[model samples]
Target: MRFVQVAQHADDLKRAAAFYAALFDVEPAALFDPPGLLFFDVGGVRLLLEKGAPSSLLYFEVADLHGTVAALRSRGVKIVQDPQLIYTHDDNTLGPSNSEEWMAFIEDSESNTVGLVSHTLAAGD
Candidate 1:
Protein backbone atom coordinates (compact mmCIF):
# COMPACT_ATOMS: atom_id res chain seq x y z
CA MET A 1 0.00 0.00 0.00
CA ARG A 2 1.09 3.58 -0.57
CA PHE A 3 1.57 6.11 2.18
CA VAL A 4 -1.05 8.86 1.92
CA GLN A 5 0.07 11.16 4.69
CA VAL A 6 2.80 11.86 7.19
CA ALA A 7 2.82 14.33 10.06
CA GLN A 8 5.36 16.56 11.71
CA HIS A 9 4.75 18.67 14.78
CA ALA A 10 5.59 22.36 14.95
CA ASP A 11 5.29 24.69 17.88
CA ASP A 12 5.02 27.65 15.53
CA LEU A 13 3.04 27.03 12.37
CA LYS A 14 3.98 30.25 10.56
CA ARG A 15 7.68 29.54 10.90
CA ALA A 16 7.17 25.92 9.99
CA ALA A 17 5.17 26.86 6.95
CA ALA A 18 7.85 29.27 5.77
CA PHE A 19 10.64 26.75 6.26
CA TYR A 20 8.79 24.05 4.36
CA ALA A 21 7.52 26.34 1.63
CA ALA A 22 11.05 27.43 0.79
CA LEU A 23 12.41 23.93 1.00
CA PHE A 24 9.71 22.32 -1.08
CA ASP A 25 8.85 25.43 -3.07
CA VAL A 26 5.23 24.38 -2.97
CA GLU A 27 2.19 25.89 -1.40
CA PRO A 28 0.51 23.75 1.19
CA ALA A 29 -2.56 21.94 -0.05
CA ALA A 30 -4.33 22.52 3.25
CA LEU A 31 -3.85 24.95 6.11
CA PHE A 32 -5.37 26.14 9.38
CA ASP A 33 -5.23 29.86 10.07
CA PRO A 34 -4.75 29.99 13.81
CA PRO A 35 -3.06 27.63 16.30
CA GLY A 36 -1.72 26.69 12.93
CA LEU A 37 -1.39 23.59 10.83
CA LEU A 38 -0.20 23.15 7.28
CA PHE A 39 -0.15 20.38 4.73
CA PHE A 40 2.04 20.09 1.67
CA ASP A 41 1.50 17.60 -1.06
CA VAL A 42 4.72 15.67 -1.34
CA GLY A 43 4.16 13.73 -4.53
CA GLY A 44 0.86 12.09 -3.49
CA VAL A 45 1.63 12.06 0.20
CA ARG A 46 0.19 14.79 2.38
CA LEU A 47 2.90 16.14 4.67
CA LEU A 48 1.07 17.54 7.68
CA LEU A 49 2.39 19.78 10.41
CA GLU A 50 0.52 20.47 13.64
CA LYS A 51 1.19 22.64 16.67
CA GLY A 52 3.08 20.61 19.23
CA ALA A 53 6.55 19.34 20.03
CA PRO A 54 8.31 18.07 16.92
CA SER A 55 7.25 14.64 15.80
CA SER A 56 9.55 11.84 14.79
CA LEU A 57 11.95 12.58 11.98
CA LEU A 58 10.78 11.82 8.49
CA TYR A 59 12.95 10.20 5.85
CA PHE A 60 12.22 11.04 2.24
CA GLU A 61 13.59 8.92 -0.57
CA VAL A 62 15.56 10.55 -3.35
CA ALA A 63 16.90 9.31 -6.64
CA ASP A 64 20.21 11.08 -6.12
CA LEU A 65 21.07 11.79 -2.51
CA HIS A 66 24.34 13.55 -3.32
CA GLY A 67 22.71 15.87 -5.81
CA THR A 68 19.81 16.52 -3.47
CA VAL A 69 22.24 17.25 -0.64
CA ALA A 70 24.12 19.75 -2.78
CA ALA A 71 20.92 21.59 -3.60
CA LEU A 72 19.86 21.72 0.02
CA ARG A 73 23.31 22.87 1.07
CA SER A 74 23.07 25.78 -1.33
CA ARG A 75 19.79 26.67 0.34
CA GLY A 76 21.63 26.81 3.70
CA VAL A 77 20.03 23.62 5.04
CA LYS A 78 22.18 22.12 7.75
CA ILE A 79 23.44 18.66 7.00
CA VAL A 80 23.22 16.60 10.14
CA GLN A 81 24.88 13.52 8.65
CA ASP A 82 26.64 13.03 5.38
CA PRO A 83 25.09 10.39 3.15
CA GLN A 84 26.32 6.89 3.84
CA LEU A 85 25.15 3.31 3.64
CA ILE A 86 22.51 2.81 6.30
CA TYR A 87 21.76 -0.78 5.35
CA THR A 88 22.46 -3.49 2.81
CA HIS A 89 19.96 -6.13 1.92
CA ASP A 90 22.00 -9.15 0.94
CA ASP A 91 19.43 -11.08 -1.04
CA ASN A 92 17.00 -8.42 -2.09
CA THR A 93 17.84 -4.86 -3.05
CA LEU A 94 17.59 -2.51 -5.99
CA GLY A 95 21.35 -1.87 -6.25
CA PRO A 96 24.62 -3.77 -6.20
CA SER A 97 26.41 -4.48 -2.95
CA ASN A 98 28.38 -1.81 -1.02
CA SER A 99 26.18 1.07 -2.05
CA GLU A 100 22.66 -0.05 -1.31
CA GLU A 101 20.56 1.61 1.37
CA TRP A 102 22.05 5.07 1.44
CA MET A 103 20.86 7.99 3.53
CA ALA A 104 21.58 11.54 4.71
CA PHE A 105 19.94 13.94 7.12
CA ILE A 106 19.30 17.66 7.54
CA GLU A 107 17.82 19.96 10.15
CA ASP A 108 14.75 22.07 9.43
CA SER A 109 13.73 25.50 10.75
CA GLU A 110 11.94 23.94 13.71
CA SER A 111 15.01 21.90 14.59
CA ASN A 112 13.17 18.85 13.31
CA THR A 113 15.47 16.42 11.57
CA VAL A 114 14.60 14.96 8.19
CA GLY A 115 16.44 12.42 6.10
CA LEU A 116 16.95 11.55 2.47
CA VAL A 117 17.30 7.94 1.44
CA SER A 118 18.41 6.24 -1.76
CA HIS A 119 18.99 2.74 -3.09
CA THR A 120 21.54 3.55 -5.76
CA LEU A 121 25.13 2.51 -5.33
CA ALA A 122 27.67 5.28 -4.87
CA ALA A 123 30.76 5.61 -7.09
CA GLY A 124 33.26 3.72 -4.95
CA ASP A 125 30.73 1.12 -3.90
Candidate 2:
Protein backbone atom coordinates (compact mmCIF):
# COMPACT_ATOMS: atom_id res chain seq x y z
CA MET A 1 0.00 0.00 0.00
CA ARG A 2 0.99 3.62 -0.45
CA PHE A 3 0.57 6.66 1.75
CA VAL A 4 -2.55 8.69 1.23
CA GLN A 5 -3.46 11.21 3.94
CA VAL A 6 -2.07 12.61 7.17
CA ALA A 7 -4.39 13.93 9.86
CA GLN A 8 -3.35 16.93 11.94
CA HIS A 9 -5.19 18.40 14.86
CA ALA A 10 -6.92 21.71 14.21
CA ASP A 11 -9.39 23.28 16.58
CA ASP A 12 -9.97 26.24 14.32
CA LEU A 13 -10.09 25.26 10.68
CA LYS A 14 -9.83 28.76 9.25
CA ARG A 15 -6.85 29.69 11.39
CA ALA A 16 -5.07 26.46 10.57
CA ALA A 17 -5.86 26.89 6.91
CA ALA A 18 -4.36 30.35 6.83
CA PHE A 19 -1.22 29.28 8.62
CA TYR A 20 -0.66 26.29 6.36
CA ALA A 21 -1.40 28.30 3.24
CA ALA A 22 1.30 30.80 4.13
CA LEU A 23 3.74 28.08 5.07
CA PHE A 24 3.15 25.90 2.02
CA ASP A 25 2.54 28.81 -0.33
CA VAL A 26 -0.58 27.08 -1.56
CA GLU A 27 -4.28 27.28 -0.97
CA PRO A 28 -6.35 24.58 0.60
CA ALA A 29 -7.50 21.99 -1.89
CA ALA A 30 -10.83 21.42 -0.16
CA LEU A 31 -12.71 22.20 3.02
CA PHE A 32 -15.77 20.65 4.61
CA ASP A 33 -17.01 22.68 7.52
CA PRO A 34 -20.01 20.62 8.54
CA PRO A 35 -17.78 17.91 9.87
CA GLY A 36 -14.87 20.27 10.33
CA LEU A 37 -12.33 19.03 7.79
CA LEU A 38 -9.79 20.87 5.71
CA PHE A 39 -7.37 19.51 3.17
CA PHE A 40 -4.19 20.50 1.41
CA ASP A 41 -2.06 18.65 -1.11
CA VAL A 42 1.54 18.27 -0.09
CA GLY A 43 3.67 16.52 -2.71
CA GLY A 44 0.68 14.31 -3.60
CA VAL A 45 -0.08 13.53 0.04
CA ARG A 46 -3.37 14.68 1.48
CA LEU A 47 -2.91 16.78 4.62
CA LEU A 48 -6.12 16.60 6.61
CA LEU A 49 -6.77 19.24 9.23
CA GLU A 50 -9.64 18.10 11.36
CA LYS A 51 -11.12 19.11 14.66
CA GLY A 52 -11.06 15.56 15.96
CA ALA A 53 -7.53 14.69 15.00
CA PRO A 54 -4.72 14.52 17.51
CA SER A 55 -1.73 16.80 17.53
CA SER A 56 0.95 15.42 15.21
CA LEU A 57 4.58 16.30 14.86
CA LEU A 58 4.96 16.94 11.15
CA TYR A 59 8.09 17.48 9.13
CA PHE A 60 8.20 19.20 5.77
CA GLU A 61 11.09 19.30 3.30
CA VAL A 62 11.97 22.78 2.17
CA ALA A 63 14.40 24.12 -0.38
CA ASP A 64 16.06 26.42 2.14
CA LEU A 65 15.52 25.50 5.75
CA HIS A 66 17.20 28.58 7.20
CA GLY A 67 15.46 30.96 4.86
CA THR A 68 12.09 29.38 5.50
CA VAL A 69 12.61 29.65 9.23
CA ALA A 70 13.59 33.28 8.97
CA ALA A 71 10.60 34.12 6.81
CA LEU A 72 8.27 32.37 9.20
CA ARG A 73 9.80 34.17 12.14
CA SER A 74 9.29 37.49 10.40
CA ARG A 75 5.66 36.58 9.87
CA GLY A 76 5.27 36.27 13.66
CA VAL A 77 5.46 32.50 13.72
CA LYS A 78 7.10 31.12 16.84
CA ILE A 79 10.47 29.54 16.24
CA VAL A 80 11.04 26.50 18.44
CA GLN A 81 14.55 25.71 17.31
CA ASP A 82 17.02 27.42 15.04
CA PRO A 83 18.32 25.74 11.92
CA GLN A 84 21.26 23.44 12.50
CA LEU A 85 23.08 20.68 10.69
CA ILE A 86 21.34 17.54 11.86
CA TYR A 87 23.07 14.79 9.97
CA THR A 88 25.40 13.88 7.12
CA HIS A 89 24.18 10.96 5.07
CA ASP A 90 27.13 8.73 4.39
CA ASP A 91 24.94 6.02 2.86
CA ASN A 92 22.02 6.26 0.48
CA THR A 93 19.55 4.82 2.92
CA LEU A 94 17.51 7.62 4.53
CA GLY A 95 18.88 10.28 2.18
CA PRO A 96 21.39 10.84 -0.60
CA SER A 97 24.90 9.80 0.29
CA ASN A 98 27.36 12.63 0.98
CA SER A 99 24.51 15.05 1.56
CA GLU A 100 24.09 17.21 4.64
CA GLU A 101 20.73 17.43 6.29
CA TRP A 102 19.70 20.60 8.07
CA MET A 103 16.61 21.08 10.20
CA ALA A 104 14.67 23.60 12.26
CA PHE A 105 11.51 23.55 14.34
CA ILE A 106 8.64 26.01 14.56
CA GLU A 107 5.37 26.14 16.41
CA ASP A 108 2.29 26.10 14.25
CA SER A 109 -0.88 28.06 14.81
CA GLU A 110 -2.29 25.04 16.59
CA SER A 111 0.67 24.96 18.97
CA ASN A 112 2.06 21.85 17.32
CA THR A 113 5.75 21.60 16.63
CA VAL A 114 6.62 21.43 12.93
CA GLY A 115 9.97 20.55 11.50
CA LEU A 116 11.58 21.99 8.38
CA VAL A 117 14.38 20.20 6.63
CA SER A 118 16.83 20.76 3.78
CA HIS A 119 19.53 18.68 2.18
CA THR A 120 22.63 19.87 0.40
CA LEU A 121 25.77 18.35 -1.03
CA ALA A 122 28.69 18.08 1.34
CA ALA A 123 31.40 20.69 1.13
CA GLY A 124 34.12 19.99 -1.47
CA ASP A 125 31.91 17.40 -3.06
Query: Least lDDT summed over 10 consecutive residues: which range in candidate 1?
Result: 89-98
Worst 10 residues of 2 by lDDT: 115-124
- Model 2 residue 30 CA deviation (Å) reads 0.4
Model 1, 13-117: lDDT tens digits are 778888888777787788877757688999899898987635778987788889888999997889999898777755455555555788999998878899888
Candidate 1's C-alpha runs over 4 A off are 93-99, 121-125
What lDDT is reached at residue 9 by model 2? 95
RMSD for each of the candidates: 3.0, 0.7
Residue-level lDDT of model 2, residues 1-125, one tens digit each, is 88999999998999999999999999999999898999999999999999899999999999988889989999999999999999999999999899999999999999999999999998779
Clashing pairs in 1: none
Candidate 2, clashing residue pairs?
A: none
Q: For residue 43, what is the lDDT in candidate 2? A: 99
lDDT of 1 at 58: 91
In order, the Cα lDDT scores of the candidates are: 0.81, 0.94
Q: Over the full model, what C-alpha lDDT does candidate 2 score relative to the true structure?
A: 0.94
